[model samples]
Target chain A: MYENKRLGLLYCLPFVIGVALFKLFPFAMSFALSFTQFDLIEPPKYIGLENYREMMTTDKLFPKSLGVTLMFVALTVPLRLAAALMVAQVLNFKLKGINFFRSAFYLPSILGGSIAVSILWRFVFAKNGLVNQAMTALGAEPIMWLGDENYSMWTIVTLNVWQFGSSMVIFLAALQNVPTSLYEAAAMDGAGKTTVFFRITVPLITPVIFFNLIMQTVHAFQEFNGPYMVTEGGPLHSTYLLSLYIYDQSFKLFNLGYGTALSWVLFALVATLSAVAFYSSKYWVYYAGEKERS
Target chain B: MMSSLIRSMVAMGVIALALGSTVVSGQELRFSWWGGGERHEAFLKAIKLFEAKNPGVKIKAEYTGFQGYQERLTTQIAGKSEPDIMQVNWAWVSAFSKSGDGFYDLRKSASVMKLNEFTDNDLALGTINGKLNAVPVGFAARMFFWNKGALDKAGVAIPKTWDEMFAAGKALRAKAGTKAYLIDGEGYDMILMSHAYVYQKYGTPYVDPKTGKIAMSAAALKEWASIYKRFQDEHVATPLPLRASLGGVEKPTEQQPDWVAGNWTGNYTWDSVIRLRGSTLPGKGSELDVGDFLTLPGAKNSGVFGRPVHMYAVSKRSKHPEIGAKFIDFMMTDPEAIRVLDLSRGIPSTAIAFKQLLKEDRLRPLEVKAYARIATLNRNNAITPPAAQFEHPRMQKFMREVFEQVGYGKINADEAAKMLNEQGSTILQRL
Candidate 1:
């Protein structure tokens, strides 16, 4: 038993070392760097909370970018979740060639966040692109999907929402785990399809839904590729999320200190939101074997 | 287990010894650059010639297209893993090396490098804080290059003055329909063109390098903003929104379909890029012509944006600094190397290479014309070279935003002017 334990420890050492070097070390260094004025060329100078104070007081893009990020997360999370749930429901049906349909739906998610896909998204939403051609064929005036500031965010939001396969897969698994006898009983008692879905299917899948809501919201907050590659946070910076702002400041502008500070704030925001989700889960999410608190 | 560990240790030692022997055998220098196919081919040939001339000194070439080159260089520099030699931009010298220590001081390698081959003005552009950070490859200035085919289709000639250009823009659109514009550019291009117009009329640069402050008053800035607006309003230039719809605002004009189709007729771009613009256009490049530097009446300056095309700098972290310097000298002054490079990197800065290329009649017609025009403008004291601060990315972004706001009608000319004067000063002061 002791030999087995020693071998297990030996096997885990590489992973432990990797996490320490790559993940934990950078995490700690970034936290420390948030207080310094590091430009990657010169040595970092400690300036206390000046970075955070500037973000609040004088950094004009901070508030604007934060608002954009929140809007992006709010718009992306629910729409993506709703899309995943609906698609998962349809895909869960006993239909012919369902596996092919499943793979096709999941394809975008596999290629979604790539730079190439983002470039393709730009062309598809371009003035004389496929979307506009379709509109023209339907005898409608083409919309400036990427050019108009009001419509630009929607283009990226639609891109994010379109890649709902991962969340749908999770939803599909949860739906499969749901008891078939419950649906049969509801059906015999004259429960309508919509009634059975809401009363049985939705309630039972609440745990997975909650899990997905938290995951998707966190993922949405950190979205960089779609906006960075597609719109470049442009058309008057309507799509300039905080992640893009951080990247521009850190890499492009070389304001590593301020970028790190902004990153910490983003981390805190995601953490607080996730904590709130976990705290509120008991109200809506039901596990199979949990006792009633009351 | 102990025997296996000993065997592994012996194998690792053998590998390390092999690597050590290879390093001792010869000096390897890594050289990086960003360019097109022709430039890359020319550079590769030059590198091969240099390697042949210098035995036991191997040159490794790393080349990429223009996109993301700066970002990659930045990360590499920060990590201390940059190439031994790099092709740097003039604007990047100050950003990367403020006190003139970012790159290896070329002045230290004066014995190895033929620094005297370049003119003082050319060398001064690459020097900062009494330290020669890099050597200028060539000089470039923004000039008008028009598509004669497109202009003829619209029944217009290349305009020589500001008012004539505006009239031409309107007339061309009237003749060629709404899809046609006399000029096509991104926001940054429009801002620079507007700066030239304002500078010619007012004799003030956007940023005064002497004091490092915003030089234009609110009224002058308002005129600058107004010129940009008028260009779009008169159908002389494409609006920001419309350009944004055509791929992206960041897309180069040469890549646009309108440019290929000759709907967007012309651009005010750098002389070095004239080859790219001319080559990308239709009809065997005969349709392209370099226009006269357009000026405004009663103007004091040409407002020609003149700078180095690019520069070669040895990295501070390079292990083979002498080899790197020698290679740079060969590229600049060697006759065979110059012949191989030809006019790919614009007109050569060195007198030897320039005379060699000129005597060989290797200079392209349009590029030569643009260079001659810029030289004339410079000789007559008609051009005021923009301060290096004007090319700062942050400053460029701010200027682009202000003009974009004016173009989108989100703000009036006066408001944009106020922002340029007030906010622009604040940003410049910080830098």
Candidate 2:
């Protein structure tokens, strides 16, 4: 046991050092910077809560950006989870060329955040892009996908949903782990397919769905590259998310202190939502050995 | 596990070898600039030539696209890791040069550049606090560009004044049955042009020279916003929805392809963009023509006309300061390099380099004509410096927002004027 503990310590030393140096240090530094005025050049000067206070009261764009980001998260998270689950269910069936389909769907998620994909997104949603071409073919007026403020947000949301392959893969793995005996017992009991699915498969995969939901919601809140490359937060700033606003303030405008404050505010929001989700998970999420009590 | 350890050892060995090569005996100078692919190729070739000439000096070139050039340079400057030599924008000269000891004074070094070969105006642009902190390489001024075939098809004459331009746009739209904006006024150029016209008419620049305060009068703001509002209301411009989708400046022109297909008219752009777009358009090269710069109707005597294009500065932290200065000298004085660059860095400001390229028959014909016209006009006009607010990103964003508000019809001329007055002044004061 002592030898095993020594081996474990040796293996974990690198990881512990890495976490302390890369993650914890930066997190603590940014937390401290939230209350300071530092332009990344001069030494930082503490200004109490002035940065946060200004963001709350004086910054007109902050509330609007926060609202837009929340709306995006609200719409995209549920739709993406549903689509991913549906696709995973379809793939779980025994079919020809199923692996190829799964791989093709998963490819976009891997490339989603890349510059090449962002450029492709711009071309796909341009005024006279493929979307409009299809619309015109359908005997409808060509809608400006990226130009109008009303439609631009949908383009970003659709981009987010289109990269649901990662979550779908997770769902597929969870589905595979579901025991076959449960389905056999349901069949023996003369339950319909829908009832079997609802009572057995979905309940078994509830933990996976819960996991994917929280992860994707956090990711959606930080979506930046799509709107930045496609519309540049334009059409009268309708598509401006809090992430893009923070990036503009920090990098483009050189307001590092204010940007850090915004980041901390975002952290607080994400943490609160995650905490709520975790607290509520006990009611709905099911584990492998859990009783089927109400 | 043994193979993994061996692989790690090999990686460390390679990195150590790379680091060992960095410690060369000769003085090494690192230079960075933002440019397109062609400019990068030309610059690399010039660096090779410089290396051949200076046996003891070595240069490392770093280049990137212009999209985030300023932000990257500012970060490098802040980190105190800026390259030995940097190709800087003229607007950023104040921002970088204000750090008194953060930039090298080129005039004090014996082996540094001699500014005598450059023009008086070029030298004047590089002088800050009576010290030459940078070297001017080129000059570019905003001018009107037109698609001759489109204009001819629409049966409209090129306008020489603001009123005539508006009338011409309306006539073109009617005849073409499509939008016919004279120019898509984007970014600071539009604001600068508007300010010039207003300053000429009122006989006052945007800044008061005596007090060093912003003079963004409510009347001027209203006038500027009204012009844009009129452009939208008259069906002369494509609606806000269409214009907002157009991508970055370096991207290919959306309207140009349509203009070639006989759907739209001209745009206002730099000469380089005009040439680049014209080359790609599916028409005879002569179909595109350059238009003369227009003046507001009441501002014919506008003295606000000059623009600083781009400049080169040496970093204060450079180990090889003389090598950096030499690179700047080559950028300013080398005739072959100038011809190879050829309006990619704008027109050469040095008289000798300009004459050498002209003699070599390497100058683009349209650029030559354009430069000649600007020179003739510049001889009689006063060259006003760029506003201090131009360097502030907040001010740039505010200007863009004001345009957006006007374009979308969310606000009227008076409201935009009010917003501009309040926000613009606040931004200027903060800066």
- Candidate 2 runs further than 4 Å off: A1-14, A188-190, A291-294, B1-26, B185-197, B205-212, B246-256, B283-285, B300-306
**Per-residue alpha-carbon lDDT of model 2 for A1-294, expressed as tens digits?**
876677677678789999999999989988999999876656778999999898889888999899888988998999999999989989999899999999998988999877788878877777667887888899989777776778888888888898999999999999999999989999999999889878898989999999998999899988988878877776678789899998888777877888989999999999999999999999999887777766
Lowest summed lDDT over 10 consecutive residues: which window, candidate 2 chain B?
Answer: B247-256
Deviating ranges (above 4 Å) for candidate 1: A1-7, B1-26, B359-361
Quick one: best TM-score, which candidate? 1
lDDT of 1 by residue, A158-212 (tens): 9999999999999999999999999999999999999999999999999999999
Model 1, span B1-431: residue lDDT tens: 54565588789999999999888567998999999899999999999999899988889999999877887888889889999999988888888998998999888889998889987878888888888899999888888889998898778989999899999988888888898889877667777888889988898888986677888867789999899999999998888899898678868888888888888998878888777777777765678888887888888778888888899999988888888999999999999999999977888889899889888998777767887887777677566557777887678778888887898999999899889988888877766
TM-score of each: 0.95, 0.92
Indicate which candidate wins on DockQ.
Answer: 1
lDDT per residue (tens digit) for residues B158-259 in model 2: 777767777887887777766455555444455555665666666666555344456657887787788666766776544455655644322445344455
Model 2: DockQ against the native? 0.50
Judged by DockQ cut-offs, the docking class of candidate 1 is: medium
| Worst ten in a row by lDDT for model 1 chain B | B1-10
